[model samples]
Target: DSNNDLNDSEQEMVDIEYMGNNNDTDSLGEYDDTEVNVAGNESDDNDKLSETFDSLDEEQLLFDNGDNDTDDDEFMDDWTTDVIQSDCEIVCEQNMILVVLKKCRGLISMIKRSTILTLYFDAQRKRFKKALNLCYDVKSRWNSTYCMVNSFIVLREIIENLFSNKHQLHITQQQVKKLTNFELTSADWHVLLVLFSILKPFYLVTTAMSGRQYPSIGLAYYLLARLRNFLQQHNKKESLLEKRLKQLLLKKFLNYFDDENEQMELIMLHAYFDPAGFAALTEIERRSVEQTIKKSVADQASHSSISVANTLSITTTTANSENKPNANRNVKRNAMNLFNEFVGDIQYGENRENESKRAAIINEFYQYRKYVIEFNEKHEPDAGSVIVFWRTYGETFSILKGIAKKMLSTPATSVPSESCFSTSSALARKERARLSGEHPCSSVFLKDKIKL
Candidate 1:
C-alpha cells in the first residue's frame, strides 16, 4: 500500500502550488500538525492530508518542490532511464535494495512521514498522466524486492531530488537534520540498476510458476533449467561481490532441486511426461524415465498374465496357432514348447507365456519412446501440456498410458493446496478472531461450502 506513491513520466510536467505557499518549505513546518497520508499509516492530526493537497495547483509544485534540478550538483539537468539502465547493466549487481535501504532509509522515512511530500508527488502524477505507481518492496514476496530496486533505477531523478542538498534546505531543519548523511551516490544508483538486471530472471521464474489458472508443472523443469543456465553464464562475468551472491543463490537453488534423495524426487517424476519438461531432460535422464515407465508396464503385464483368464487366453492364442483354425491347417506344437508351458508352477506360470506378455509391454514402451523422442525434436517450446500429450497418445500405448495417468497428474508445486489453505486462512482472519472456538470452526468450515 505504501507502494502507491509512485509516478513516472515527463509529458506535461505541470506546476503545483506549494502547500499554503510563498515557499515550498513553508508547508514542511506545519506537517506535524497534519495527519500522515502515506500508504495507510494514519495520524490523529488537525486535518485530513488529502484536503490540504487537493487544494493545490499542480503546475506550481513541479518547480516549487525539490523537483527543479538545473543547479543540482549531483545529477544532470536531463538524465533519463536509458542511461540508468546502461549503468544497471554494468555495475556490481548483487541485491542493492539492502544498500539503498540502509543508506537512504532515514531520508526515505523522513520523506514518507511528510504529507507534504505525498501532496507534491500526487500532483505530479496528475500532470504526467501515468497509471503505474513506482514499485515498493513487500517483504513477504521475493519478486517485490526486484520491483523496489527497479523502481529506484527507473525513478532515479525523483529520488535524487528528494534527497538532494537543496531538498534539505527546502525542508524543515528538524526533518532534514539526520538526512544529510544519507544521500544516494552515483555508484549506489549503478548498483541499483545492475541489481535490477540480475533479479529479472528470478522475477520471471516466480511469475511463470505462479499460475493459479493453469497447471504450471509442465513448465517446471524447463524454467528451472533455463534459470540455472542464466546464473552460471553470468557468474563468470560478474564483479567479485556479484559472483559471490550468484554462487550463494545457485547453491540455495540446488538445495531446492536436489533436496530429497530417499523418498521424494526433485527432478519431478511428472516432468518426464510434460512436453516442455521432457525437452529439458538430458539423453541419460530421458532413458532413466523411459526405463522406469517400461518397468511399471512390464510389472503390470507380468501380474496380469499370471491371472486365470489371461493365462487361458495366452495358451489358446499363442500355442500352435495352426491348431486354432482347424480347417486351415493342423500342426503339432514342438515337444519343447509343450514342456515349457507346464514347467515350474503351472498355476503361476513362471513360464515363457508370462515373460512374453511382459516383453510385449516393454515393446510398447519402446514404441512410446520413439514417438516421444521424435515428438520433442519437433515440439514447439511454448505449446501443450503433459495431460494433453498423454491424453492424445495414451490409446496407442495403453500400458504406458496407465503409468502416465498416475505419474503425469502429480502437481509440480504445492500452490494448488496452498491456494485452498490461503482461502481458509483469509476467512478465519477476517471474522473468527476473538470468538468462540467452535463458532470460528463452523464459520471457517462453512465459508465456501453449502450446509446441505
Candidate 2:
C-alpha cells in the first residue's frame, strides 16, 4: 500500500511540473507577438511623418512664389509710374483735355443762361437768379479768364437751345452799358469777397452747384470758410471739396443762412474787413484789442463771483485735508492767498456761507478770463461787428491760439510750408496721366496726408 501511495504522489508532482512548463511557453509566444505588433506600428508612424514633412516643404515653396508675385504687382502700381506716364503725355494730352473742358464749360454756360432768364422772368425764381449772379461774380474773381469766358459761351448756347429763339434775345447797347456800370459799395462787396475767398481754393462752389449738399451759395460759403479756418489753424493746407463732387446736378436744394452765432461768418467778415492787420497793426492797436477782450472776459468773471465764492468756502471746510498733513497745509495756504487777493474786488452772494469755496471759484474765473485775454492778444480776430458774427467762427482763432501756445511752450519746430508743398507734389504727381483730371487730382491731394 505504501509503495503505491508514493508512486501516486510522485506522479502528481510530475503532472504539476508539466503544467507549469506549458504555461511558460504560452507567455513567451504572447510576448513575441506584442513586440512584432509594436515594431510594425512604429515603422508606419515614421513613414507618415516623412510624408507630412514633404507636403509642408512643397507648400512653403508655393507660398514664397505667390508672395514674390504680389510684391511685384504692388511695385508696378505705385505713383512713380503715374508720374512718368504723365510727364510723357502731358503736353500732348493737356491741349486735348483743355478742348474738352472748354466744350463742357460752354454747355454749362448755356444751361445757366436759360435758367437765369427763366428765373428772372418768374418772381419765385428771384433767389435762383441772385445765386447765379453770385456764382458768376465769384467765378470772375478767382477763376482764370479762359474758364470764365468759355463758361459764358457754353451758357449762352444752352439758353439758346432751351428757348429755341429764332431771333437772338436782343439787348440794346444802352442796356448793356447800364448793366456794366452797376457798382457795389465796400460793405456790399464784403459778402461776395469772403465767399470767393473761402470757395476758390476749396472748389466748393462747383461741388455745391452740382446739387451736392443742397448747393446753397450761402451755406457753401459758410461751410467752406469754417473748413478753411479749421485747416489753416491746424496748418493743414489741403481742401476737402476736391475729393468729392465731379458731376453733381441740383435737381432741388435747400437754402442755408448764416446764423447770429455762426463762427465762420464772423471770421470771414473779420478777414474781409479787418484784413488781419497783424503785420500792419501798430503796437497801440494791438494793445487796445487786447484790453477790450480782457475787459469782456473780466466782466463775465465778475458776474459769477458770488457762485465761485460759495464753492470755494464749502470745499475748504468739507475736505479732510488733515489726513495728509503737508498737502493739506499747502492747499489751505494757497486757497487763503487766492481768497485774499480776489475777495475785495469780487462780490459774493451774502446767502453763501462757505468763504473758501467762493474764493476758489473767483480765482478760477479770473484765471479763465486771463487765458482768454492772452489768447486774443496773440491771435486777434479780424475787425468786424461782433454782434453779427457767429460764435462758431471763433474755432479758427482758438486753434490758432492753441498752436501758438504749443509753439511757445515747447521746443518743437513748426511744420514748414515746403514740407506741405513736397507732399502735394508727390501726391499730385503731374507725371501720372490719370492725375490730369481736376477731380482725380483733388482726391489724391486730399488723401496725401494719410500716406505721410
Candidate 3:
C-alpha cells in the first residue's frame, strides 16, 4: 500500500548530487534507479501498476509540467555557472588594469594580457572553491619569483581544466594553438617541482636571516652548514638534471666559503659563541677555533700585565705550626696518615709556583670549552640564546664575552636598514613633509616599542 498510494511524480523524482569527479562527469544529468515496495492487502502484482498508469494522463506522468522537481536543480546549476563566470570576468579585467598600471613583461605579462585566458582560469578556481589569484614576480625579489612559480604549481589543475575546456570558454582556434604550447605537461611539472624544491631552503634561509627581532649571526652560520649538508645528501632516484643542479649549487657555495682559513676563522668565531653552533662544529674545526682564540687571548693578556694564573690561585706558604700538638705516648698517629700529610705539604709547595701567561691562557680556554660543552648538552640552543648565554656568563669569561659582544651584534643582512628606509619614505610623504627629525624618530620609537 505504501508503493501503491505513491503518485507517478513521487515514484519518478529522485535527488541527484553532483560529486564533480571524473566518474560522475559522464552522467551529469541522469536519473538514478529508485525502488519502492508494495506492502498492502493489495495484489503483489503488475495489476496495481497497470491500473495506476492507465488512470494517469501524459500531462501528469511526463514530469514536464509546472510542478517539475528537476527545475530548481537545473536552474541552480545554470545560475551558479553564469554568476561565477561573470565575477571571474570582472576580476580578470581588474588584474589586467594592474598589469597596465605597472610595467610587466615575460610570461606573467602575457598571461595577464590574455583577458579570455585569465577569465577562464579564474572561473575554474571559483568552481573548485580555490579563492586565490595568480601572482606576478617582481624584479628585485627572488621570494616573489618563488611565490609566482609556487602559485602556478598550486593552480596547475585549474589551468589544465581551462585548457581542456577551450571551446566551452569561447577560446578561438588560434588561441588554442598558442595555449597548447604553454600548457604544462607531466615533464614540465616534474621540472618545476624539482626546481622549487631546490630553491626552498634558500627562501627559508633568506627569510630567517632578514628578520630584525633576533640575532642572525649564529643562525646564519648554522643554517649555512645545514644547507651544505642538504646539498651533499643524494637521493638514489635523482634525475640527470637534479644531479647537475646539485653539482652546480655545491660548487657555487664552495667557491666562496670552503677551506679558507681566514674566512672560516670569522665564521667559526661567531659559531663558537652560539651553543648549537659550537655543537655543530667538527672536532678538527673546534680545535682550530680554539687555537685561534688562544692566540687572541695571549695577545690581550700580554698587554694587561695581570697574571691570570695568579688571580685564579690562592697562594699559601706551608708554615709549620708552633702550636702543633706534641706527640703523646698514649695517642701515637698511624704511619699512613703521616705519609698523607707529607704528600699534602709537597702539593702545597707546588701550588705556590707561579704559572706562565701562555700556560694560564691555555688553562682558561680549556675551562671555557668545558663549560660550553656542558651548557650545550644541558639545554638546546637557538639564535636568540647566544646573546643571553654571553650575557649570563660575562663575569666567567670576561674577555671572550667582550669579543662576542662586538661580533655577534653585527646583522647578517641589511634588511633592518632597508625597512627603516621604507618606513621613512612612507612617513615623510608630501602631506607630512614639514615634520621635524625628532618627530619621526619619536614616532618610530613609539611604533616599535609601545603596544598601544
lDDT by residue (250-333, candidate 2, tens digit) is 100111223334643333322221222222334464445444444544455555775677788678657756455665565545
Tens digits of lDDT, candidate 1, 1-452: 22233222322122211112224433334444442333444543314544554533332333233334312312123434333223343334334546575554334333443445554443433333322334334434457657656655655665555555334223344445445566788777766666677778888877667655446465677888888887676645566655656666677676656554532243545667677787788888777776776666566656775676666767877886846677645567788877877673355444576577667767875786677777667667653555566666778975667656666555556776688689889986876566768776665555467666
Instruction: Report the number of the highest-TM-score candidate.
Output: 1
Task: Return the TM-score for each candidate structure.
Answer: 0.59, 0.19, 0.56
- What is candidate 1's TM-score against the reference? 0.59
**Which segments of candidate 3 are over 4 A away from where they belong?**
1-107, 138-142, 237-240, 259-261, 301-360, 378-381, 420-452
Evaluate all candidate structures by whole-model CA lDDT and list the values in order: 0.56, 0.34, 0.57
Better of 1 and 2 by TM-score: 1
Off by over 4 Å in 2: 1-265, 268-296, 299-311, 315-452
Candidate 1 deviation (Cα RMSD): 14.9
Q: TM-score of model 3 relative to the true fold?
A: 0.56
Q: What would the per-residue lDDT of candidate 3 be over residues 118-166, giving only the tens digit for each residue?
A: 4444445555555445565543444654665666677778766655655
Ranking by TM-score: 1, 3, 2
Best by lDDT: 3
